[model samples]
Target: MAKSLKSPPADLTRISTRNGGTFPLARISKVISGEAQLPGGHGNREMPVWGPFFSRVDADQDLGRMRVDSLARYLRKIQQP
Candidate 1:
């Protein structure tokens, strides 16, 4: 008897929850402008914030399609009341 081949499980992508688990768009801009603040009442100081920086792609760039329902659900989960 031949054994059946098993398929691998689907990959699960996770969102980062650092910095209060929120996307800091304003904070990022402030940091770029040299006016960012530290958390917990710490005095203002220069800190190196490193992350991926991508150039602006065309509006019609087609990497792939995202499920709107899934994205809406995720956004709803993270939204503050």
Candidate 2:
């Protein structure tokens, strides 16, 4: 996962059909909300899906949201200018 994240495709706007994956870094919020979809109906590439994973971790909606937000913010911060 670290390797993949460290070397994402140069063009994030384009979706890759071959791998059934999407770089939600540019739109992290949508991905977190399950509003993003991939080919073959596979949801966001992140296994276990962070939204549900965070919810299960604490069973608190606010805490889950905080976790997702923190992740999204981190992604945004690391993006190249």
Candidate 3:
């Protein structure tokens, strides 16, 4: 006889603020595929996801850190009041 696995309880901590007020799996898949707009009209199509990767590269010892430091310094200067 094959044993049946019981279904887990629904997670109550999840929340959403979009039109449906829930992050449906289908919508998340669409967003991942660059076919859906996020809340407030923002979408992944307009932004490149490279900041964290560059940060990691900046911290690597084998790569030159001077250019990364210079870019960081420039960004800090631009953000100064």
Candidate 4:
């Protein structure tokens, strides 16, 4: 079964904002694709590389792309107005 897309937790979002994490969709897409590193570089030390992690879960590039796209879209939707 595929993992469902969901908004990030409010605490995490708040922390990101506190730490200067406002990234545009294009950059967010790159982060999702693993083409570009996340801002601040902490993800490199603390978290699994999402691109590879998501890929390993299903081992399907197309499905991984869909999942990443869905997540990126969700992040975009939650930006402060």
TM-scores for every predicted model:
0.28, 0.51, 0.27, 0.57
Candidate 3 vs candidate 4, lDDT winner = 4
lDDT by residue for model 3 (10-76), tens: 2223323322454455544333333456434532234333334444665664343333444434433
lDDT of each: 0.35, 0.54, 0.39, 0.60
lDDT for model 2 comes to: 0.54
- Worst-scoring 10-residue span by lDDT in model 1: 49-58
Clashes of 1: 0
TM value for model 4: 0.57
Winner on lDDT between 1 and 4 is 4
**Native-structure RMSD, model 2:** 7.4
Better of 2 and 3 by lDDT: 2
**Candidate 4 lDDT:** 0.60
Clashing residue pairs in candidate 1 are none
Going through the candidates in order, what is the number of backbone clashes in each? Answer: 0, 0, 0, 0
Q: Would you list the clashing residue pairs of candidate 2?
A: none
Candidate 2: list runs displaced more than 4 Å. Answer: 1-26, 38-46
Residue runs of model 1 more than 4 Å from their true location after superposition: 1-16, 44-81
Off by over 4 Å in 4: 1-23, 42-45
Who wins the TM-score comparison? Answer: 4
